[model samples]
Target chain A: MSQTRDELCWMTISEAAPLIKRRELSPVELTQAHLDRADAVDDRVKAFVTRIDDKAMAAARAAESEIASGHYRGPLHGIPVSLKDFYDTAGVRTTAMSKIFADRVPDEDCTVAASLKGAGTVLLGKVSMSEFGLRGHPTSLFSIPNNPWNLNRSCGQSSSGSAASLAAGVSMGSFGSDSGGSLRNPAHSVGIVGLKPTFGRVSRYGVIPCSHSMDTTGPMARSVADIAALLQATAGHDPHDPYSSKEPVPDYSANLNDGIKGLRIGVPRDYFFNKDGGADPETLDLAEQAIDVLEGLGAQVKEVTIPSVADVRASQGVIMISEAFAYHRQFLRDRHDEYGPVKFRFMLGALYTAEDYLQAQLLRSRICREVAEVFEQVDIIATPSMPRPASVQGDMGHPFSSLGGLNFLVVFNATGHPAISVPCGFTGEGMPVGLQLAARPFQEAALLTAANAYQQSTDWHTKHPVL
Target chain B: MAEHPLPSHDELDARLKGAGIQLSNEELEFFRGAYPEFLDQLKLLYSYDVTGEAYPFDVALFQEPQ
Candidate 1:
């Protein structure tokens, strides 16, 4: 067995699981390896907000004992994973990165966290995030997690720590929630795979709310297969979650290697790509190259117009701001100083008039209908994940700073579609670029299938940031 | 590309005050100047015809059966 640190640290969950199942690698050994790696890299990266070493080691020992006693839980059985701070862990601090709830410890684990533990995974710790998962940058009042690729660059997120931790090899996989590009943006910036599953696919019960309607918790990993494995372990209907759907959860890993031949992929040239001065040239180039790869794999690619994506963004923003304000109104009013400036001012200042909020919801229905029509023609839509490459913290403005009055990822959030960001290429400075894919609501299986096909055809996702 | 009318700075400031969001004079001016563009951009949502369908904004509290 290779005893090299890089070999052990960089192995994907898919690779690690089989080894653990074969008894070739004990759960205790794997858990210790990651804890040691975290100790080495975490200070610089600040990926984890809370380190639960003793609890994790105990769980690993239990897993080892169970496997030895001929009781195997599943694929996740010894896999080390991290949870975003927004996830509620019973008896553990689940601060949403805001001082208002800094001492708040839930009495029950979030559905996703409980599900992963039930599947026998060991939780490494809670990853850092934006304040209340409210903003997109690392300027939260709490300790901001630095991007691993460039210590000074913004990791692009509410899931800032999840991306950083995965890039730093602190965990094989992690959980992240997306309201507006929270998952995709960081994944794009940090060069990892992040999925925003269909809104009701993963139970959000116990996860802190950002936008009640748009928040989705999903897996972030280094590879498509690893994400699929984590997704399989995390997704299912839970009765406690009012919005949880009884929709069947498919076996994501079994069909991942299915080729993209004969699949119809639509390129929304006008809305996503050809919009005036929208995406940077390198991003556009990478996306076009990804499309070429899909075409090469026997996918029928066609240019389709997605009417009024800008309108979708606006409506989504209104709903997001209004809903967020409603959720945090008391906190904002009572604990005003506890919130970060950007999120505080933005949330408080943007409380939409009842008329504006209602109109936004009505408009959301229209945008969703329009997108639904587009999905009827294409099995999935592909575009650049972000308009540009990751920028150094000072070089770039605030993460939520608008680019010509548009929020790139909010449109899909408004439509409640399942979207993902997969690393497609790198910029001149070696920063990662991402290609985004969106499928109609509840079509995550198709989206993952297509993404898996793309992963097999290219080495893009294989490239990791050299920390 | 269609032209849309937006509320002026004074109108926006007055509206903010009416809405009970207390802002300092400087903050009021700043937001007033910012409002026209913000309103213009937000008006873009009116371009789409989403009138009757249910908006997808429901929240989930727990993952167990209620």
Candidate 2:
């Protein structure tokens, strides 16, 4: 069947890959459709920081030539993708949405960028993020991206532009990092899918560091199958990042149809279901209904306790900033005013004594063991991706107002487990909510399997925002 | 577990100075507003006593390889 221009822009990489390989679809056409869509709609979504259209067209033509010559590489060949500005691209500006790096271009591509290129994916351009992934400051050099669902609402921070771009069909897929839900937060807000693989599963080589111990690079897209395809191209060990795991990388697309039959799903209700100023009632109800949907699909569901989850948000806050302080120390000394809203937060790290930081790390170790123990009894842990859906743009801040409450996503970051956020349901106002499912370390195949099954059984993922 | 207290603004100012960083008055006020919340989070983490809990404290594990 012939696809229209809008259809071409919205087509998932999974659907487009085969057509491109068969020459039924031209990569140049696909790339141009996206560029046209961005030209038409990005004024409202404000997603891209830089659009390398000429280079993208060149890459597409090269991809077309290779496939016609019978040198097709893989599923990602000729697929257009956005990279979070945090990634260091060789000749393109890699700003991380900060004034300090606004003019800084790299001499070589980061590991993730190089791999996607080797996979034959077309690089659309660098996208916006919160200044240094802390939060958007009033003085940030770039404008904050707006949510496609509602122009007044936020697309979420750090990976905000990546989410807005995909949701608005400006790019089919994106690569973003999550030190503390940077990718998944936007995925949840914009009604898409994002995966934060196990901490060491993907190399962080050349990506701007946020919190070294907790930062992760993962895939984001409009659908789980697309996310699986992107992850398969990017997830592996790199000698450049010694901390990258040496464990074998699984084919994320292998068992996407392997249903979650009898798979145990645990819901930690007490911590996440806060009443007096916890997660919004609408968010919790939709997540609960999502759990019910999985139960109906033959998955065994139970309410399990991971009590330490309450304490993890706090521990992560302390450790993340403390580590970030070390990285930004020189910058603060030389270019203090150049930092964004993160400046205040980064300086907070200075007040912390070495004792305070290590004590929190010690707590982190204990919490990781406790979470691992819970995993022994259950295969997956399910929770709402955020306490609420997207906030109104211009209201989001560095230390979120919800910081005092429980955060469901931060725990996995602390324990270094794989987590996936999939669009679950919507609020009465039509904003989307996300269901986050996490599995044991390096069990991304299992994670993708469950996420894919859920998306297949529901239309939440297929619902797109009308710009 | 003992409660860890939030430092006074002057004390915090001194710490920032020791780190070779100085903030504008507005920035200092912003820190004042956010510090209590951070200290509250720190309190929760420190509340758990790990008196007998041993965690790796060696710097070599994190130091640049030879």
Candidate 3:
């Protein structure tokens, strides 16, 4: 009762965890605050595909009882979180925002979902996403999530609802899968944080496949520290996922505020900032300013280049479409009409020769080597997460878009590096832009530390979207 | 990357048909427009001399030390 419900809704997991541990903030109160906020704003934000109020409240009660019995489960113990509907949730319809899976309910939780549940997170129900995380599908089922900052603008896809919910203050934090920047794009689009951990860092055992080689389950939240907490809960090896890493999971928060006093940051501006490459001038300006902040924090910033990086979107698209078509081969052959606009994009894979796929895989390996050489000289690479700020929903045009354009994002998905998108600043038009930083493989801790330092030095994350 | 000319619209539609997939006129038009860009992406990889005779598995895509 001492703290207003508004404060409860906006408090990051890092801020609320200690309060909950001390019994000053009950899990039940915190969960109810978010539920109320969702009830008040979800219609316009369209973040959740399924809002299980009763189930969420019941879970909150259990968490409260467990903590009261002196059984605290750590930072994410009582957090209210949503999974991008791509994750399979037991007994819940895990529609990947596609009509093809609209009626399909899973009998088991995906590894990430089960792990978060085990960590005592209250499931706030599944959120909307692009059909198979492959851009907008014309005939998709759920309403596209709108940017909470401006109703006319859109929350970028695949991880649309995941970003929207955090931006709208209807959920504390969440997990969203990124393949070619699905999570980071939306994270920056809506003014939040998202981490695409190293490819195998988080298990993808139960996620609906976008591209098996590239699909990575990661965390999305309003702040970098909360992203670290979510990552901590679900990271590490999973026997079910063959790609899962056996690497030791580092304590993500231990060095979060350590500051990047002597870190080396690399800027690959030629590729990401090419105005001809779809980089918006304002977004690039904000990204440059963000890098300057990192330099001010004692990070050495120097321009570096990743060979053949400019054309990665082509490799990413070819590989993604081909694999996606393979996954949907039977569906496309049988229920072709059921696929939304994404089906057209997915089917574009069938157009590529098998040799094209092989070439893409080969290109991925080269990118890995190039990025490693760059990492040898710098601790992290910096760029704008998205090409621009959120555009008006109507201005998004048709669901289909070209993937061969110069893309800064898909490069990491191919190389399998740890990447984070932190709130950089807003545009003159009042939309948020993200400063994306990626580190060497399995170096998510370094990514978080630098991002947390940036978040701390700026008031960007503190400025929430007015619903 | 050999100079593989862009497939004509009829050639593309025939390719889709040959693959047992059918598309609406609008869908075909969209694919018809995007196919060139898609092929161009493939060309970028071949344009580079990176891939050798044996494509080695890159473990860097998995767990790599910082």
Quick one: best lDDT, which candidate?
2
Off by over 4 Å in 3: A137-139, A275-277, A397-400, B5-11, B24-30, B53-66
Q: Write the per-residue lDDT of candidate 3 for residues A1-467, one digit (tens) a residue.
A: 68788888989998999998888889999999999989889988899999888999999999999999999999888889999999999998899887889898999999999989999999999998877887754346867888899998878777989999898888898889888889998999989999999988999988999888888999999889898889998999999998788888999989998999989999998888777776789999999999999899989888999977876776677787788888998888788788776777777777777777777777777777788888889999999998888777846554445565545688899888889999999999999999999998888999999999999899999998777
- What TM-score does each of the candidates earn? 0.92, 0.96, 0.96
Model 1, span A129-186: residue lDDT tens: 8777766443444577778878888787689899998988889899999988899999
Residue A152, model 2, lDDT: 92
Ranking by lDDT: 2, 3, 1
Clash totals for all candidate models: 9, 0, 1
Please provide, for model 2 over B1-66, each residue's C-alpha lDDT reduced to its tens digit, 9 standing for 90 to 100.
557666676786788889998777787776778656766776777788865453422222233324
TM-score of chain B, candidates 1 onward in order: 0.55, 0.59, 0.55
**A23: Cα error in model 3, Å:** 0.9
Which model is ahead, 1 or 3, in terms of DockQ? 3
Local accuracy of candidate 3 as per-residue lDDT tens digits, B1-66: 456455665776787787788777886777677665655665666776555642322554453445
